[model samples]
Target: MLLGYLLEIVKDRDKAEEHLVSIFETIPQHIDRITGDGVNTWCELQRLARTYLAGTMYADTTSEAKFPNTANKFSALMNDEQHAVFCSIYYYGKTTAQLAQELGKTEDLIRKALREAFAIIRKAS
Candidate 1:
């Protein structure tokens, strides 16, 4: 499932496989942190995988690149900022800090945008 998720993000099986390898390489460190009450294993693993891929992900993006094929009605419902923030973290595997820096916003604002984006998704669903 993780590999499928990554493959959806990267649109490249080899890159997705590499990221999967890298994520699994460091999973031991995250396992304890994710093993708490109410923890969602799939969500936690996705977050961890995103973090590991964040640095490498943006390196592959071009300014003219279109929105990913994975974009759905949920994403279409977002405002531009919300879409950018959400897609960057949710698909491109960016951290809030990275998005904050890239967008010239504070971390709080980036987080807020992410929250708003999720809210939109939840509401639309």
Candidate 2:
């Protein structure tokens, strides 16, 4: 699922597969921190994938291209808060803590917004 999602953004099969492999390799180190009591493992994995891809996707800072264009129909599906959370984390590559600081909100609230954004994206799909 993460590979498929990466494929859509990166638009390269080899790179996507490489990224998927990298994600798997790094998962073990993060497993303890990412998965805690009552924390949905799947959602945490998705969040990790998104964070990794945000770094990878924006590596070429000189490029004007972006993953989730505002004009895209999928972007239109998100409400204001969802879009803000999604764009900041995904497009701008901001972490939840950074977003919380910048937006004057709690880290928990940023996480909640991110989760809601993912829920909206899932519903759209």
lDDT of each: 0.78, 0.72
Model 1: weakest 10-residue lDDT segment is: 57-66
lDDT by residue (tens digit), candidate 2, 13-122: 89889988988898998988678898888777867777787676444332334544445566677777667777766654677887788778999998998888888778
Q: Mind giving the per-residue lDDT tens digits that candidate 1 earns over 23-108?
A: 89898888887776899988899888777766774445424254466646787788888888887777766678877888899999
The per-residue C-alpha lDDT of model 2 at residue 26 equals 88
- Go through the candidates in order and give the C-alpha RMSD of each one to the true structure: 3.0, 5.1
Candidate 1, position 59, lDDT? 40
Off by over 4 Å in 1: 55-67
**TM-scores for every predicted model:** 0.71, 0.55
Candidate 2 Cα misplacement greater than 4 A, ranges: 54-65, 69-74, 78-85, 95-125
Candidate 2 residue pairs in clash (backbone atoms < 3 Å):
none
Poorest 10 consecutive residues of model 2 by lDDT? Answer: 59-68
